[model samples]
Target: MSVTPQASGAASERTGLRVTYDGVVYPAEEIARGAAYELFSADEATGFEWAPRPGTTWPWRRFVHVTEVTEVQGGNEPAEEPEAPLLVPLHRNRSWSSVHQLSQQPAAADDPTLAAVRGSATVRRGTRMVKVLTGRQLAGYVRGWLPHGFCYREHDIAHLRTPAGLAVLRGDGTSGREGTDIGYALRWRAADPGDFDAPVGETYRGLLALPPRDRLGPPVLGTGFVPSSAQLIPEFVTRDFADLPMPANASLLAYTAEGTEVVLYTYQAEQRGWLRMVGPQWRHLLAAVPGLSPDQEYVPTGDVPRSTQLVGSYAGGEYEAVADLPGGFRVLAMTRAARFPVDSVARRLRYARWRGVPCLVLREEAGWLRLRLCRPDPDAVVDTGAQCHERGVYETWAPAPEVTDDQVVDLSYLV
Candidate 1:
């Protein structure tokens, strides 16, 4: 819809000026010396409308969560200091053919040159990390799963907007399923670059050596990118394959085959829940999500244990904090006014051995500690009695007293 920049008046001073597009109000900021306005919103507000701007491309309305007014600039900003190889999008007409050819390439796990190039890629604290999810994985994250395993930087793949365009980047090995019209993804700001490691070097050689049956997704291409013959999108894994705490405003999204981007849900870290944003028309997307009711407006996740958390000290007391980011980290409070920037913040995680298996302590109950296997294999799952929640993720509970060598550690990644 045509976005009429609100006049610079009293309303601009209060909530800043906003632009309405497709019935949603977005807080707009003047960027590039006022040549274009960047519209961004963390909330899922609606009820406003605007006429479509003439000559707008298909991606215009698809920029649901963030977009620049000029339409030429996608939400992802180019790196201030380029380190990785430049990536250019293929012609829309040739994208599918190119992706198919690239997906067929043999894994380049032993390519030293490619590995070094990929290893050189870096993630800044505020870099947007993206995990393309299957319908089942999307459901898991909506429930309580934190960001873990393999992911990519949003800056590298912003041009791939549609389901077909993103097929090459799928983490699941199996492809070419029919009737798949929508693609799902989770995007969030990186709380710390140290939490990520390129799946290269001797550390990940074992992952590359694993037989096909033992692994879930595509093989780890030491090239630090997806299994593509041409795409240079660098891939990363959480350090020690541990879960990174979900930051505030993390978004669960859906992209139609036609390239319409839908904001399915935006995480509310304070409430430890997801605020559903998908309208009635898109409710069918949730049909594939196991046990999740499409009609439910907000899903509470506080009760579900997590592997890592953001904690902060404020007013002489330690409290759960949310990474609001750019604005900085703050203590998560019930009311908006109560959320204040904390005096100190750190990531709280505990590692322990249960039944001779390395596990990350999720949470502690009366006498039991919920633990997730750091690396899930068939034997580990059986030994720990861990239930398979999703591909490559397993969790179970153990008696707190029986869990040996329990140690709580706090990490600070603030710059």
Candidate 2:
């Protein structure tokens, strides 16, 4: 199915707006005013193929609450809303455990209804994706860690503004602690929907099989949703568990017990750094983030190694680029005017082992591979002489030949 925004002036035609559900068309205006609560997907849907208006990020898909629709254009009653689907939660209550056990069965993936609901969760270019962080994880992103692993869409979890409300989504497994009143998250616009994948089907079966001790957070539910008893928020993982290139204007945020959302930092893609956005009143939040100074106004990420980078060809020469997605990709240049759109674009990242430690090859120079530990631990740092850039992030250089099992990874994209 093709997903593309309609050309200019198409949105102004009210007659052109329509929604199709179960093969029936309805006026979008009536749906918007009555049953529709949100847009779910633009792909394979009618009337939603229009682009988001300027300064808006809404995707084309519209989600209509069938039960809420009182009437239809042709006088037919709306279908009953399907029963809320069950998702596997970590806590074991009698009622939930029985259903949870059922989800673990191999045939669960073949359930058509569940599969369709899982497939409904989609990301578009400009959809804001958020990864709820612990204080430690927040510091890693500040230092240079790229977005990877599990994340959620901001649209799905916007109502979860308080620490208590958001605790269910945390990746650090510290949500069970008493008196926990603060939460952190990294939010960025998706450059492409292909960068994400639902944690369902045969490809993700291994994540579900991981032992408790081997994983960091709640066990993968394998039902394509977060492990929450009260919420059915769908979950997504970066494809192949690889890092996506950080886009411009990504924000590091904090949520308080009082439900206040504060912007902690905004990434400056052009400068390769994060500009502190929190004020002195909220500075105390930084205390829990190791090695980060609340007083520092800016932190440079260029020094820290990154796993993925946007490389573009401009004016017959290739240069490192930055993604300002939904806006476009451009050469990473210092002056604003000189930042020309590249003729071609591709992502470049390398993977290899240094001293038996899996590392990301950031760059190569003179037979040396600048490597960053994929999973940094004390022993890994010691083995590779990787210096601590910040908490949990380490980098060092190794001879090219010593970097065994080396492989270059490249993904091309349209300019």
Candidate 3:
């Protein structure tokens, strides 16, 4: 029932279909197309796909795919219904409510950092505040659907707002932190509908081309705010650290307040999304580690091995990475041993698989290694006897080396 007129200079002008499902109606072209694609795509349409919004549950799935779609105009008679089960109605497709709590004042009225500011867009709705997305954020949302087995999408343009404007808010938090943050997205006018791989927010002026739309009125916000427990994209808050090269076989771990963490695998490149700690285990680790503080950094000294080396027999010893012990202070488990044959510690560990069968080797700190168990026999016990002898004969162990300050990236920025 709520409506916000398209921005003045949108690249295209097209009438949107009015779709009624489960009693609620949507007038946005993108919503209509998404709804139609879900409910009325031809039986032979091979490429149609849908990205079920996050936190979708039972029963709703039955009705989302309808045998027949009814496009409402002028309040015409209801279309003939199939014998299918009733569809669950979504209310918040086309609504906007003023935000009440301002997190940070809107971008200084005229900051040149629209993309940066917009990248972290949050809008006010009544007394509640929500996140909004634009550009790549929107595109990523649409793409997330297909991979999750929603439906194969043909044209992403259908998701675009008329008049070719940016700052398309995925009403409420459909693709963001539900009930908390509103998602803002940008729809590119020149985007190839069939090609969803196009870069987002590439054309600066193009994204900011349309004048901002005024958002205030009734139908205030979409009604169907699905209860979501997952965020479409993981957000990272970068901080400045002394950029420096890591020591041999070392990794840096980053932790945040929401029980979220990512291991920094900088050896190959400045990569992310390595091993993580979450769920019950996260709760356990969170008991320590500075109490789950966001933007907290945990640099590994690689002095103590995450895994323990056990001498099963005289032949060799087995090294398996194990969980960390909870504590407030750090201790270095140091020992001396003979050096190994391999040039690099990673290669040495990689060559130590007892059965001569190859498995993934994840290097912890120095003197410790964890095998990425990939063999079918989950219960198969590993023989570290031969490897232990090899280690004593071919490898040398020394005290955990000191970490140099210059090896960190200076990502700190002033608020």
Candidate 4:
């Protein structure tokens, strides 16, 4: 049987997807009956597409294949042995077939952490130092379904060796806050130890060594895609932790009380590049660290200036910001071209359920929208989308008189 990587604009045409199922890559026609799967669009040169489905709005199910993949040596030759999956580096993009292939393989044969995850009989969660030794181990695995690329960076490679195995801990000087909507941090284990002996960047380059395509599309645009497997690691770890079943009397505060006392100047730290926690979370920190106190030093932050093009008129005026919110943040509109009120806007900005938690969308600066969980900060200026929903209102940032819901083009072309 013949198998090949999908072609440009093939999805829109009669040619269906190149789907990977049960360790095999099959054309759309050859996909086994009753197979459960998702779709991936070809690289930029080939535009994104959606199939006829049962909804007025698009479901965020399809993903675009961003990695460089092509036919290998003896392109048309018969298979000698099932081809070993190509392992892409952490924080990089991969083709759907590559991701599917990598997911099936064992992360590491001798890794204890993975064994714990699988509920292996031999693995044990012993009394280990909590601070010095992190419960989380860096394991290797490919991104399952989400679109990945922004997290890639150049940094010194660090490895942590536990009773489990050698873990490749990703280290970068860049701030985590900078990037497109963070999909999730990926933890991977090396399939081969020799992969570690080589420089990490060199290894990544080797894995991503496919020749460049003559026709490539621009990078994905903001708000065009959502990550399906973004929180896999956190969810998996949380489930495993819950499954272990700690005792009813288990007190996290008491548990840490037995450990050596550790003091932290949280407020001072926040002033010097650390994050500030509020309320019960602060108590949780106090439980973990001995001498920590609430914002006793309550250092106030000055308002960061943001200029918006606000207009006042008779039938209410046209108001728009010079910048639009970052992609992925959903918003609710309170008013259109009305005199911006200070008190009423605060009342309108209440937390609503987002991904099962309360959230408000605030466009802080150009190319960045913050989905804050707690109440909006005192200085926050919330956007009502000018009477639009989710990301639709962002279209008004264009020079046209006003952008409607139908006018929002597929910005994924930039992606």
Candidate 5:
């Protein structure tokens, strides 16, 4: 959470928002070069929506007007002029408005620019080295739970310190990682509960018990668990689960050890229980992980598992490929499927029933095998194919594409 809390003169502005970014608000004219945003709102939450934060809209708060802009000398072009902070009261419901215009391309607020001298909101805490993530980053983390059919949520977190240790009871860390809302939360480990701060920890734990998919109420609370003796109660709780269409008042748990330098771990779940690698080489690993779909079949051929049937055929005197398959019966105009598996599925088809009519001669030229996305894995037992594909039947990780000429397939088109 690098968004610096810009104190609104003796008053609070955008009180409940989960701050997503912070930077100089770009002027409307320079919006393209100024900032980038996700078009998300609590009203219609779905995907990673991008846009600038909304502006003020209350009655008394609306009194403060946007001050005149004064351009500073810098950049090849002029620097963005700053608008003096105003104190305008807005309707609490619609109070959260973008600082920039919303109807058109927005002048993004400043969030990306960083300096050696200036520390981020994460850095300022000074207790634990924080891994500050953008709402976009947070959303991606939430999506990883899809394969296993789980969903992770965001909540306001405020770790209030206590005597036993930092016990959170009512902190916004369980706050929403929202599109329209923008706010911040902190994660720290004081020597003891009250060693450094009070109320913050108790507040954080309390949020874990919040009900799921409901974001309109106060944050929930959690029972104290010894960090050393326990694993996250449900492994899924600690993961960066994204498939969650339903949101829960999730926990912002700290390492139980006293000042053990709590580290944050991110989890991503796919259609299966698959996960992308986390930490070091994350850039390269994330890029490669999706490409390597683990096997998704139910049977075994030699050491290989039954998977998508990928076969290339000679059609019209030219060499092409067959589409890969995971199920039976397919329709392929041209076949040139590749060999790869996500969990245990394969990508090669040795043969398929050549479709035909009983005694119909000219009408039945006999069509060959076809490839597709969700077909079943091939194996001996019709009963076995069902069992294996459903529970990782294959052993071989399908090889890469190698369309050899002599390969045989049941279809006449196969060479």
Candidate 6:
């Protein structure tokens, strides 16, 4: 019973993925089975793994996240106790395995103000705030899953106990747009090393501190293959207020809300910063209850620059900025390309059922064909053997390509 981490090229240009195999390689069926139980919500990101039928395409799989797992230690020896969940060893694989995660703070998770950026689609009438929180947490988690390196920072929010919640705001930062994506500002309960000895608390200290660094590919090209666990349980306390003791064993808490986020805009402040997760979601976002500034300041996020490349039809229409996903997929945000109208692209995506999901249809790049898809699918079964002519027709930046469905591609060397 040996476990190892392996990563291969993905189906898209922007997807991050990694594969774990025991003594024997895991069949696609097993991978598909895990999807069913994979905990995708950030607040519920325990990383145990989900069980779903094998997907023809990647949905909420392949990203970066942490799992609080408890396995009996002193292996090769008799089992002394049962498995438990402990906060430790964040998974940095680009592989879809990251889709499976557990939650540390369920309360914040249930709030809708924090749902995913796509909450509008999943959110239904009569939805509670908790469901919304889950959606928002997913957005930031996916962003950290970017194929390249992501700089992780730390922040301190003074006054853990605030008359106006500024105390909690000290340690954390706001995420993305409020009407769209909401985020939370939480601090983890930093535990003592001795605490991990018990099975209940997350084992993030000592020998059990990490989930095997091998799981993270390489520090550079494989950003997902970075630190598996904190060298020590990092303690986070509130900032900017009168004296207040922080929560022990606290590290993160996510919630969503419908208001402007509090940002410590000083560039020097961002220099040695903590994680700032902003996205369109319901969970992990907190609503501006009667307490914190109720009138709601309508400060618009300044214009994000357009991209060098435009995706989809050329007939330019309503478009967002060209967005960059974790893997390698980058396209103007749901906007229209030059010739193709954004409306038609929307219609096609609705027809294709791939509105939010990223994909790579072959397009020309420096004369050679380049695949541009959303977060690349780890262990993607590309059909290169099939002639290039068989590939599907897709619209892309500068170079337009013919879309051919289900072409066999050969990438053994890259694999």
Using lDDT as the measure, the top candidate is: 2
TM accuracy, model 3: 0.20
Tens-digit per-residue lDDT, 1-415, candidate 2: 1111232123323334444555655443322123332233434465343435342333453444433234444322434322232233333453544444444444566666556656666777777789988888888899898998779877667656557777888776566374367778899988777778887877666555544543456777777777766565778887765678899999998876544468899999888889998778889978888899999999988677566888999989999988886678998988999899889888887789988988877678899988766654446656888764322235799999887999887788766
- lDDT against the true structure, per candidate, is 0.67, 0.68, 0.22, 0.21, 0.20, 0.21
lDDT of 4 by residue, 1-415 (tens): 1111232124313544455433334333211111112333232212223433232122112321212222111122222222122223343454444443333333331233322322211101111101111111100111011111112110110111121111111112121222211111222211111111111122122212222221111111121111123211100111000011111111111112111112222212112112232344333433322233345333222232211111112224332211011111111223343323211110112122333323333323454433332211111112322221111111112211221221111111110
Over the stretch 360-396, how does candidate 1's per-residue lDDT look in tens digits? 8878889999887776556676788886443344679
lDDT for position 63 in model 1: 28
Count clashing residue pairs per candidate. 2, 3, 59, 12, 124, 142
Worst 10 residues of 2 by lDDT: 1-10
lDDT of 5: 0.20
User: Model 3, 1-415: lDDT tens per residue?
Assistant: 1121122001112343344555545332222223222222212222223322222211111112221345554332333221112222224651111111111222221333322322332211111111123223322322221111011111211222211111222332223232221123221111111211111222111212212231111111111111122111111100010011111222222222211122222121112111222333333322322223323232222232212121111124322111111111111123213212111111011222324322333343554444332221212122222111100011112122311111211111111
What TM-score does each of the candidates earn?
0.70, 0.66, 0.20, 0.18, 0.16, 0.19
lDDT of 4 at 332: 23
**Per-residue alpha-carbon lDDT of model 6 for 380-404, expressed as tens digits?**
1132211111011112232223333
Worst 10-residue lDDT window for candidate 5 reads 356-365
Off by over 4 Å in 2: 1-107, 176-179, 352-405
lDDT of 1 at 278: 81
Alpha carbon deviation, residue 145, candidate 6 (Å): 16
Q: How accurate is candidate 3 locally (lDDT)?
A: 0.22
Q: Which order, best to worst by TM-score?
A: 1, 2, 3, 6, 4, 5
Cα miss at 168, model 1 (Å)?
2.9
